[model samples]
Target chain A: MKSSRGLRLGTTLFSFTNEFHARQYSTEQLILKVAELGLGPGLEIVGFQSFRDYPEISDKFAEDLKELLSSCKLEPSCLAINADINIGKDRTLTVDELVVYHEAQIRAAAKLGFPVARCQFAAGPEVIRRLVPLAERLNVKLGLEIHAPEAVDSPLVLSYREMYVKVNSPYLGFIPDFGASAKALPPSFLAHFRKEGVPEKIVCVAEEVWATAEGNFGARLSEYHRRARQTGAAEADIHKLNMLFAMLSKQKPSAWIEIMPQVVHVHGKFYEFDKDGNEAAISYAELLPVFRDGGYKGFISSEWEGTAFTDDNGFEAVQAHHALCRRILARA
Target chain B: MLQTKLIAENGLRATSTGFDVEVRLPWYRGLPLSTVEIGDVVLNGEAINPASVSIEVNGKTRLPGDLATLYDERWYVLDSAMLHVSHSELKRGEQYDVAVSVNLRPPYIPGLTWAVKDAKRLTANS
Candidate 1:
């Protein structure tokens, strides 16, 4: 997984979790299986629920696990930690709670000798800024994942980047989920318009009406929903999505770089693949060029999350993506 | 006589001669409807013209199709609550020999007014 100048390739282990359901493989066996991926320089173990039940990680503890990665000839890219910020439940936390809950994970990551502990953007900017000093002192960077359906061109993203620059801390970085990158609207959308049974004239009129209305993002989205429903244009939904993704790739270059310095890990996701072993859901041909050109030499974890959860062709899909990704990285 | 379970996907439109009814209404989200014709014009059911109102007399089976059309079609006139032209008024429990066609659209938020007209009525007491 190296470039022309030896840029190493690594990915998350979450993608292959389903594969080892065979023969009741242990976590060490899974790590060995991940190393077998021939894909990773390592694996970022996800902690977002019952993943901790694996025996190898539970047996040796963090130090042993750290030693084991080296022993297995693989690197520990990151720890998938769960911090209970509960942004919806409570907006503000006292400084002590912030340290106890938030800063503890950063310190723990440092203690475990990992460079990063990914944090959820649960609270607002004030919280993120407050924790930066603690993260810097712990010598462990915090990478907030920019995930999907939440586009990079999203106001939330713009606001996050603006806040990051204003705060200007080295400890704060981002892991822009490549899945989100793939989740975009394509540029060529006239065919979609036709599928929705909506004439361009109707959409044009609706857009005109929407502008003057006090339509926020939700309102605009609902209005679009209404139009699609009105014109019975379900097929137009895909075209609309393609248009959104294209918008993201085009607009988020600065945002990408702004958060890139902090990107310790990334979730490279896929939805569909083709016969020649290319992802059909998105044009990685277009996006991979941007990631390489943008100097994003980081972990592109194959987060195999989609309808694949129900597919009999489980990790086979992941393998194709891995080969496809290797090809992309080689070109990069 | 031919019939199909269809929908007015484009919704109902009002025109001078007849209405362009996209047969999509209610649960029939994406069904295709047969083009119904009576006169030279295509018999699209969503005609929103300033037509007549149904009295007790129009409800009888003896009334013709054009009268039945006027009876079933509903339009919102300026300042009037809404224009409802129908031959029969069948209450919930009062069983009567009734035959009619109704095409409905899911309540959609208009890009203009934020009025939840159909949705309001549908979910009002529920």
Candidate 2:
């Protein structure tokens, strides 16, 4: 099963957010560590969140950043940008205003040497349509992230696929976060809830409800509420159960094949990498093959998210994830 | 995502006229005080005047009435400053819905702002 398409491994700076915020590691240290660990050459960064003075970098700063990446042997993969509709408490940005805000980020991404700019879920089709022209002119692709709770068949996702098909432009596409393809609830999440005093029975009931629930999100949520009430769940516990619906999706890995062509970037979202160099929850063993077989030539950025749930070192977790991905891809 | 850290327990202390709370820079990197603006402060559904707020950072207290420069550091700390808010009403031991509205003007792109409107629970101290 030799592949013809390029499938380069990458790491998103977000994986190290906790470390960065804790002052344990700087962006330069993270980039150098990525290179030092041989964790692929590609790098994805959250524009404003990662840089010290993002959305405001001077030419000198931009040049210095590019040189830093070059010296560390890392290539810019994508810039994750925010599409904030609410700029104030009582004020929401108009569609026109949103276009301006997104365009500024797009320009910044291009200036920072990234080929793609990853937009959040809030960047609807209309906003993306408005951004397409600017993206094309700047030669940077705009990828709408398909994160958890957002199934591949979700209306918003479908709408973006339709728009992409109609426009048939490379400037607009999707960045599929592997969290949507999770097979089971991440153990770290369940542990977190348990530590917070959520009873194990209640957690099990929530997992069962999630696994067997059907129909639209609203209907499924109502069913979960009903089930929780039947179990005599407390008000606070019921509320915690509701959060499960927002964190995990029931989509199979095969579902991605339908929209594989539009996937310009990949967020290899994982919670824990076990001693065997395998993810404890997500079935990467099942998902990476689909991407490999689908001929996904783009970068799959390792996005370790366990830092929020546990005190584990993000640097080591990301390194382990890269190893796991390499083994899977090698087998394919 | 807007990052926030609570500096003290029951961080909001009720005053005769208003309330006072302390906050640090949301991130490890220090931002220019001139580029920072505290637009509105809300407690328990009541909105406090943004004008009555003064920021204390780096041992120098300055009221950013019109974007005055303060703090020469290049990065933000966990206990950066205190926000003195003037409100006519506040009670003790009651949980208040606290929301802080802040806007940062990062230099790379002008007219593009990062606004943070996050809510946290604060028990008002008498």
Model 2 misplacement above 4 A: A1-5, B1-5, B8-126
Clashing pairs in 2: A55-B108, A55-B109, A56-B107, A56-B108, A57-B108, B18-B87, B29-B75, B29-B76, B30-B75, B30-B76
Candidate 1 on A1-332: residue-level lDDT in tens? 35623234565655654443322355566677667766566567654321333212333477776787787778766665543332111133454565565655565566556676666545445666778887888877777777643545577666776888898887777776665544233212333444546566545534443333333345545555555466654554423433232222323334455455556666666655667777754566765666666676656666665322232343565677778877876883
What lDDT is reached at residue B52 by model 1?
A: 37
Chain B TM-score list for all models = 0.17, 0.76
Over A117-226, each residue of candidate 2 has an lDDT whose tens digit, in order, gives 99876667888888888999999999888886788888868888888888889888788888888777777788887986887777887788777887756777787788
Top candidate, metric lDDT = 2
Q: Candidate 2: lDDT of A250? A: 65
Q: Please, what is the TM-score per model?
A: 0.55, 0.77
DockQ for every prediction shown = 0.01, 0.09
Top DockQ hit: 2
